[model samples]
Target: MYSRKKGFISRSSRISCTTNEVTGRYSSGHSEDNSNETSNRYLSFRGFFRTAHGSSKLFLGCQNFSSLVGTKSGIEIDSDLDDGFSELEGPTVTGGMLETNVETELVEDDVDGEDVEMPHDKLELSDSESDARKAQVPEELLKAITTAPVQSLDKVMVNWVEKGNDLTRADITIIMFYLRKRHMYWRALQFSEWLELKKQLIFTERDYASHVDLIAKVHSVQKAESYIEKLPKSFRSEAVYRSLLGHCTSKGYTKKAEEIFNKMRDLGFPVTSFACGHLLTLYKQTDKKKIADVLLLMEKENIQQTEFTYRICIDAKGQSNDIAGMEQIFETMKADGMEPKMITKSNMAKHYIFAGLVEKAENVLKQMEGEMHLACRYLLPHYAALKKADDVRRIWQLCEPNARIVECMAAIEAFGNLHKIEEAEAVFDKMSKEGKNITSKHYYPLLRIYASHNMLAKGKDLVKRMSERGCAVGPLACDGLIRLYIKAGEVEKADSILQKAAERRFVKPKVVSYLAMMEEYSKRGDVHNSEKIFYQMRQAGYVRRIRQFRLLIQAYINAKAPCYGIAERMKADDVFPNRTLANMLSKSDPFRKTEASELLLYC
Candidate 1:
């Protein structure tokens, strides 16, 4: 079992407290009021500050923690970080707690033949110094981790520690938060695993939840579940289960998510808005009919509705074309003392645009003024839907001077939707000329425009330019390129490009890309290539959905080829066909003619 040290709070609380202290210090130029609070808080070190002769190597070539703490009185080390210091066996100093003290240790200086004072493994820091150091720690760690190559993260962290930097729980909390905010889940998971292996900080439920969430994102939900099972029982709280549930919901595994939800209830954990919100979101996508039941249950449980909860409800109502109902929910949300967030308003406006209620959308956009960087993306598309080219142009102009990347992409889409291909091209050209840090995603809208308009030559040119400019030709680009080739009747070229991309270990084609190829091959009665793509998809570890199987069977029927073991194949893949697929299966059956003849004779 892992150590259950009580001195450490959950990661969230630590971050909140640290943020308050740092904000206070920077705002007032002093954190005198927070000094006592800082002294009482504990900080953990990972055995990188030992002063014993021939002891463990020092971090980053620093002789002691004095440089990090600034002065001897800046920090005070205590022995209460871990209970009994049980892991500090032999000459290795495992971990220590930092609290408040003015006492300093003195040592004889051999060179000067005089006594000198050295800090006692500085843990807690004084007001101004500690707050500044606290703010700086995350910056240094983020720079080190993000700048290094993925394979070198562990070595880089080790080098950082060896440089005599303090590795506290608070630093890890802030770093992980930033890593996740930037969507660097793989690197975040790697950092978490490294921390655990090095026994840096004691793991809490919050840490386990974050780890499980990252594993689900970077690896698989199955792997996440396995990791959860191995977690110490005390750490398997609602947050961990809900993390798994949220991912399952995202993947639309309704049954699995419901099972997790039931497990949460069986464990006697109170169902919060977070758990119900996932359920509502899942049902909103898969089974909108079940949304009412979830909301009713939330009301029955007396759970206070949060912004997310109301947003999902509003979306459900809007999607059902219940404009009045959606407004009512919005009013109820306000009555519950919750103001609508930007995303909530954006979602409502999106539904309004879809419903042809442009005036309502305009009103929502009006409320969102001063946040033009955000609201402009919404406005461009809403105006595009109405074919208001002038309005689209006006909004696109508003995005100038400091337009975000997303707004630029939205403008391209809005222009494309209005069939203003030249305008879209002009926007793209401007982005390129301005050197606006375009990524592969910026290419997608224009590529899609060319594909939809059957401008195969233009699509090919853009893709070539992308390659020449060192932009990544990822799966989405490959998908659009494949569509262009198919539209131009160059099926062979499409297949060749997809195969090359798949052959490269770094680029995995999207499921839609594979499906598009399979569908074209099926239409041509090319059962062999269809089946090849099918198995390649499986080998690539893409989830084998029923749609792929449907396309494969269509290829067999179109070819008049008698497919063998199709039922067994589907069963092995745990994908049973529905009525339409079953009909197709009978048509492709090897013995179907004989069976029909036998039935005729019996009749």
Candidate 2:
């Protein structure tokens, strides 16, 4: 038997276990007259115990308390209830109260049992947890992770994970990809190391290669080597070695690159064309002999040479001025059913240019018309050097179809230099009509052309338009305007313009503007003003070049003002007078002609 005491269930002494059936119900064998009284006593004890214990359920061994107290008349009391019935009943109740308490405790236990089963139901999910992983990482999360401080990265990742965000292998890979693309290699390495230590991610060969490459780029080659050494032997494959070799070659770590290349060879890894090409390019300038060796090895090993292989070999030969060697390689390249790219054709043109065969260079450029736009900026200067102004114009026209801002600017400058003012103005107008952002660079050439032609009003109008359009007239255009005023013999006007430009802060005058003023003052034999302008240029932090010293020395010598000291001053400023300046000084001052001639030897 069980009885409640101080909110706890305790075993009681044996009680009566008698049953009496009435109307298909079982109950304790009590008199009908006392039935009502006993029922009342039982109900009162049950209510009191419930209020005292605050628990409606109790377990006594394997028997349920509610089963002992059957429904109303069906109640069956234990046979040994008399042992401690008095204690449970107290003064106002009978054994029925003990039975009711047991029944109530059992009811509470059943209700509590239902609560224990709830957790098991929650354990089953509708789908795989991994299936919830996103294909692409969230941009906001990526931005947060990337912008977070290096030390806080772990915390950021942890917080993101704790927020129920699923991070998959693909998501991790995307993060590393962006980090590497942005050259945030150190951060990528840190992320990779964290993933590795956590062991939550399974890294593939590509992932490992990214890590190794980041190590090489962000840390040192020695660390990269250590990382490779620590990698599982299965991960150290040809692709991994090739990635390392490529990094070494790019960084000019020749010895380390060679070691990696040889290690691959000794391990019997197949020599790929990319690997051979990288080594060839690295040694092109420093060691052509190695390039020859690599070419021979490629043939011996039955390795196929791609167009890139031919290009590197050709570049190698060109660097050595081996024009015939380059030509031979070019023929081999064609025989291999490979069409030369712009870079290949450019190399051939370079070879011809080196040999002074301008006609052959022009022919190569003609063949390269489809790709000439990319090379026109450099090619135009070469043509200008050869006195081929028509060729320069032809190249400019060829480049116009796909010309960007830089190409357009280059065309205008080229035309200005060649004195083709109409062509320069036409290009400028086209650029303006196309709505390309016109910066100060676009204004320089046209302003110089107008200034050189003595069209002062037109230049001033252009400056006004520039200001109206919110484009400040920069130092280059201002220098051109000042030079124009100087050329027109409007010295006072030029000085006023310089002062106004300084006052307005539209453009800070550069050394060129001061040099222009000095040249004008020198041409007028105003040595005092020229010297004063030179000193002003110095105060403005202009490092005096040889040309500035030459101009000032000539002006001083022209005025015959202690000109011998100019040579010593030139030496003091580390601006040695060249042959032309020495001759000018010797002729201008015969008294110091011997000293100037002897100083020329030292220079």
In lDDT terms, which candidate is top? Answer: 1
What lDDT does candidate 2 reach at residue 16?
14
Candidate 1 residue pairs in clash (backbone atoms < 3 Å): 59-162, 59-163, 59-164, 60-162, 60-163
Lowest lDDT sum, 10 consecutive residues, model 2, at 67-76
lDDT of 1 by residue, 277-326 (tens): 77776666544434544654564477767778778767766765657556
Candidate 2, 1-603: lDDT as tens digits = 012221111112111111112211212222122223333212211111111122212100010011110010000011112322122113443334322221110100011001101101111011232332344656977777665654787888788888998887657756765554334555667788878887868876766776777677566668888988998999987767777877666544455677788778767788777778767655553233345345545654677777887787666556555565567668767866899877678778866887788888888777676566567765664565456679778887888877776667667767776777788888877776674466444576677778888887777666655544444344455566677777777887776655544432111355567767888877776788888777775654344255567678778766766565666776766554545777766656546547667899888
On a 0 to 1 TM-score scale, where does candidate 1 land against the true structure?
Answer: 0.66
Runs of candidate 1 exceeding 4 Å displacement: 1-151, 166-175, 317-331, 334-337, 352-373, 433-437, 464-469, 500-508, 522-525, 531-603
| TM-score of each prediction | 0.66, 0.45
lDDT of residue 503 for candidate 2: 38
